[model samples]
Target: MNLDELRTIMRQCGVEDGVDLDGDILDLEWQELGYDSLAVLEITTAVQHAARTPLLEEEVALLTTPRLLLERLGTLTPAAV
Candidate 1:
C-alpha cells in the first residue's frame, strides 16, 4: 500500500507517534520510528494482509525503511503473491 496507508498500519502495530508518522518519514529506520524487530515483523505481516500480497521472507528481512517496503510491494502482483 501507499505511505499514508502504511502509516496507519504502523499505528495499528503500536508505533505511537503521529508526529513522526505524519512527517516525511519514508526514509527513517524502523527503530527510529519506535519499532523493534518484532514490531517490524508485525508490520510486514500487516502490510501483506492490507495489500493482499505475499512478501518473500528474505525480502522482508532486508527491509529497513517504509520506502523500501513499499518499493518491494510495488514489484509484486496479486497473482505473484
Candidate 2:
C-alpha cells in the first residue's frame, strides 16, 4: 500500500517499463505506459496481492497513477504541507 510496495507490485506486473513512478500514474498516457486492458487487469491483480484487499471495479478507476493507486490502497499517508 506504500509507494515502495506499489512500485514492487508494478514491477512484478511488467507495467513499470518506460514509466515514471516518481510523479503520478494517471498523468501518463495508458498506451505510452505499455498498458492495455490486460495490463491493467494484471496490475489490479498484483495490487490486490500487494494490498491484501480485493479492489472493487470502481477502485480501478481511482487507480490512475501510482500515487493515486497508493492513495486508494491506503498506503501513502498525507504528509504535512
For residues 1-81, what per-residue lDDT tens digits would candidate 1 score against the true structure?
887799899988886645478887777899888899999999999999989999888889888988888888884233232
lDDT of each: 0.83, 0.65
Q: Candidate 2's residue-wise lDDT over 1-81, tens digit each?
A: 666666566566675456675555544544567777777778778878766888888778756655566666666654411
In lDDT terms, how accurate is model 2? 0.65
Q: Which ranges of candidate 2 are over 4 A from the true structure?
A: 15-17, 20-32, 78-81
Clashes of each: 0, 4
Per-model TM-score, in order, reads: 0.84, 0.66
Assess the local accuracy of residue 52 in candidate 1 as a C-alpha lDDT between 0 and 100. 96
